[model samples]
Target: MRKIPNNGNLKMTKVAYPMGLFVCLFIYIAYIKWHWASATQAFFSITEAAAGARRGQQAQGPLGTTAHGHKVFYGIMFDAGSTGTRVHVFQFTWQPGETPTLTHETFKALQPGLSAYADDVEKSTPGIQELLDVAKQDIPFDFWKATPLVLKATAGLRLLPGEKAQNLLQKVKEVFKASPFLVGDDCVSIMNGTDEGISAWITVNFLIGSLKTAGSSSVGMLDLGGGSTQITFLPRVQGTLQTSPPGYLTSLQIFNRTYKLYSYSYLGLGLMSARLAILGGVEGKPAEDGKELVSPCLSPSFKGEWEHAEITYRISGQKAAVNLHQLCASRVSEILQNKVHRTEEVKDVDFYAFSYYYDLAANVGFIDAEKGGSLVVGDFEIAAKYVCRTVENQPQSNPFMCMDLTYISLLLQNFGFPENKVLKLTRKIDSVETSWALGAIFHYIDSLNRQKSWAT
Candidate 1:
């Protein structure tokens, strides 16, 4: 879960978890406290240092534990997705007037997502609490109250009935309140699709150090998951922004800089959801009392059971004479119709794609799963055609691979990427897994800072 730098000569050992995290956590807190030195110092004189000491408790620590006398801090972010729930516990180190840098991350995941327990809110708590325990283990006991813990449910809960989703979040909040970690009113919630896409973009650009550079152009991000897919990028062309439809573009201000980006999330366009749609089945619904879901995208005689969101579906290939690839492509196109917004600027922008996109490419030998690699947009097209044709004849093989690959190809085309456009597929960039959680933590901290006026 933790990615250590290979170039660092610092001696390392297995015992460096909580202690290491403790130091890092204090550094970040000190960084924040240092920023509020003016307000903290003024209060130290007017109201005594006790008040300021309490405010800077986690942010300021002994100098021997930190390099620049800056405190380290921790953030706990839970990614509650359609397929599973995951915990990302991050430790950051920072000095005064400097940005926090991630030093370590402890991550874990559990199956049968929070959404799976929609019918029973009580059943979801054990899983949520298990993830929280990960934070408790890694973070020092004294720092728990200073650490902010949050859980953001994505498409899984978003697709659930509004009341059910809210109930699940409330249950999680109850659990959070019981934990020692700092929690707030905004600690538990369902993330909006727009925010999901934009946060992922922030993560990608942040990792690439593009956001820190004065004039460096940021790369775009494409995140394909189990229940939804997101595409976000900064538009370089003025016309692309001006001519775009509302909600397709969002303005974000971070660290005194504003960025207008093109971002959108298609909820039902994720790989798993696309499989259900292409197989002529509705999400979260039984198919007519054991009726089968038949599609040309599978082996002609292929009949099998596919499980999604803890429900199994009886699925098989159609017996029609229509070309499977042609028909499947058409079906995917229908799903894409009017659901995706495009900007010509994406044609010239570089992109880093992850999640299901990286998984599928890695499975098909199109790219390295771990090391990641670059490929043309046409690579997916090529893989789709071959897999669809081969799987058509070899029905017993992975029948859904063809459909999933084809849908990805078409999805990219729908996003205005040309066949010749190149994209990078990766799970981790620079030893850290690229995800929206990091961006979410930064955003959460920004909000807290605004509340206390620490970011001014």
Candidate 2:
């Protein structure tokens, strides 16, 4: 029958105890995911798992137009890669910070990249339209007009001759103009290797919150694209920047801060392009009189047709070779000599390797094929040696495997990474896809903000 007064602290403990436990559990799980996820699914799933209320993804400036009771935005990015063309439709929600957070993304890819249509730009229209339709379906009809659509062609386009590359861009622009979404003349264009590498670095650092803090150490980025490869990282030592050649150092402004980084894109030295070069096949030039090109890198008994930039060449291994790896290493050394700038600082810095680098490491059993993992620089060499030696005895296997692995190993070594150097090979970091597309969107939004601020 008697009522006792409630002890505020005692009662608060009851509520806070469960709440604190929940927060702790959540943080623990997030830490596991951020540090220990093994591999990743296809592009679609990574974006689906993105947490809502992301930082810096807020409404109006760049993400998208708002609707009833919801802050929704959209950005369409098309990656015109060498092997394929991919479209990324990103949706974001307004968050508490100056930046907005990503909620979900729609991704789709088609084979035989844009470069394949260099001779017939019209053929690229259908694929581009299909990708555009994906954006149309994901974004609400009302937001289409306000949504910004952009397409950035990678090494595939850059590797093409100037006029031909322009033709592809013109065709893409025509396609974008016909679309219902927002369009701009500057939307469709080729992305140089340097931008590709730097953008990827931004995506990684931003996702990991490295750039959000002052004086936070940032990881380096290694992107092995189709026709080119890029390496970008913030150097701890100023000497790294001072000793760099012209155009290797890039200055970037992000979150109101300027960062000077060591970045370089090696044109015509991507895995596939390097393969062509190492095989003694000239880019944009077929063998003389339709003759097959023979090289020491391939198995002596093997011969096949190799397709690159829309040209198919008959290729075979040299018959005079003994010790395939040694010969192949010598050839790869020649291909990479004076081609990629070797940096001693990278030997001590952490790196995130992606694209073909991840694929090759995964396929060779160095890391999880889906849930990627860390690998030593020696893993590539080991795989290359084994694959090359294996192909020599069994010449019926895929020929490029040896060359690709060998090239990756040679490329890393050329970058001054020791055999035991550890590199993180990943597909997704913190549920966001690890690609330049995300960074491209961020840059677009920043430019929009800068323009608006300037006008005011």
Candidate 1, 1-456: lDDT as tens digits: 898786444545545676889999999999988879967556334322322333333333211024335556778999999888999998876565555677788889999789999888999988888888889888766567778999999999988889999999999999999998889988999998878888888888888888775567899989998889998888888898889888888888765578888888889888888899888888888788989998878867788899887679999887863577888888888877888776788889899998988988888888876698989999998988887777755552566887888899999998889999999988777787798998888778766766676645
Residue-wise lDDT of candidate 2 within 75-129, one digit each (tens)?
A: 8899999999999998765543445567787888999899999888899999999
Q: Which residue runs does candidate 1 get wrong by more than 4 Å?
A: 1-69, 395-397, 454-456
Which candidate has the highest lDDT of all?
2
Please give each candidate's TM-score: 0.84, 0.84
